[model samples]
Target: MLLALDLLGIFVFAISGGLVAVRNQLDIVGVVVLAMATGLGGGVIRDVLIGAVPPPALDDWRYLAVPAGAGLVTFLWHPAVERLERVMNVFDAAGLGMFCVAGALKAHDYGLGPAPAAALGMLTGIGGGVIRDLLAGRVPVVLRSGELYAIPALAGAAVAATGVELGVRPAVVVVPGAVLASGWRLLAFRKGWTAPAPRVSPPR
Candidate 1:
């Protein structure tokens, strides 16, 4: 179940990456590279941080293939894919929810304390998109956009970590945790919500 959730998250993230590449007019190779990086980058970072060397992504051919397949599909059918931007955004939120919860559980399972595990979980959710945006030469949406993205990821991670720390079953926590994160994200989108920005004075 966990492995399936992980791959679903990777596939969604890869599709988002491929979409970005297509929007940027990147060639086929670039599309695939970006997709693979976005799909695997966060998990790789989380694994390395927890001292799980030689990350599973590197050891598993299926992990590599999923993103590559997503990229190719996006590259070939981008026109249709582009038309589904709104739907894709919702899937991205779902992916974010899955990764954050999974990351927190995995970190806790690896002997990390709740706080650090929660932080790593948030990283697992946002890290790939940050890398994708950077490589694509754009400000990360998490940083610059006034949208409720990272906050929900952090919320989900915290929920998962806190639940585990309190001796709750991980399986019991996963669904509610993911629903909280993704539901909040979708609500924010539907309600036209935006995060506050710092005030700036006009130039004299």
Candidate 2:
């Protein structure tokens, strides 16, 4: 179940990365590189932080194949894929939820306490997008888009981590946790909700 969720999340993220590459007019190599980085970067970061060396993404050939496949498809059919941008954003929200929950659960399994596990989970949710944005030479959406992205991710991670710490079965917690994150993200997207930013006075 976890492996399947991880791959699904990777596929979604890779597609997003591919789309971004196409939008930027990058060549096939850029498309593949961005897709791979977006799909695997987060898990790799989480694994390294938690001392899970040779991260599953690095060791698993399937992981590599999935993102490569996504990129290739997006590259070949970019116009059609681009037309589904709105739908893709919805899937991206779902992917965020899956990654956050998976990340938290993995961290917990690796002996991290609730707080750190939740933090890692949030990182896992946002890390791929961050890497993709940097490679594309743009500001990360999570940091500057004013969208309610990270908060929902953190909320979901906190719930999963805390629920597990309270002795709930992981299997029982996963779905609701994912729903919480993804539902919130989708709602924010639909409603045009934005996170509050610091108010600035006019420059003197």
Candidate 3:
């Protein structure tokens, strides 16, 4: 199940990456590169941090194939790509939730403490986005400005930790918490709901 989730999350993130490439007017090669990078970059980083040896993306060629396939699908179906805006947020939310929870749990399982594990979770969720934005030369959504992008990831991590403390199985607790975060994030995006922006008093 976890492996399946990883692939599905990769597919979702890959689609988003291809959409970004389309928006940028990138060529097929560029689209494939970005999609693969966005899909696997975070997982690679997570594995490296936890000392997962060669990393799953490298060990399992399907991890590479999935994003490349997604890019190809996006390229071949321009109309479908055009239709993605309606459902893009849903995919993004799902990727974020799954990656964050997985990252946090992996970290904890590797003997990391809560704080580092939580931070890893956030990194797992947003790291790919950061790389995508950077490579695309756009300000990162989590860094520049957004409602509670990273916040939800952090919350999901905490929920995972709590579940661990309570002895709930990961499938029972972490998965639902991730789904909840994703759903909430989607609703927040559609409704424009966000954490209060930092207050900057009028200059004296």
Q: Which candidate is the best by lDDT?
A: 2
What TM-score, computed on C-alpha atoms, does each candidate reach? Answer: 0.95, 0.96, 0.89
Candidate 2, residues 1-204: lDDT per residue as tens digits? 767867888999999999989999899999999999899888889999999999988787999999999999999999998888888888889999999999999999999999999999999999998999999999997898899989999999999999999999998889888999999999999999999988999999
54, model 1: CA deviation in Å? 1.3
For residues 9-122, write the lDDT of model 1, one tens digit per residue: 898899889989988888999899899889988888999999988899989898999999989999999899888888888888999999999899999999999999889989
- Which one wins by lDDT: 1 or 2? 2
Output the lDDT of residue 24, model 1: 89
Model 3 CA deviation exceeding 4 Å by range: 165-167, 200-204
Where does candidate 2 have its weakest 10-residue lDDT segment? 1-10
**Residue pairs in clash, model 1:** none
Worst 10 residues of 3 by lDDT: 161-170
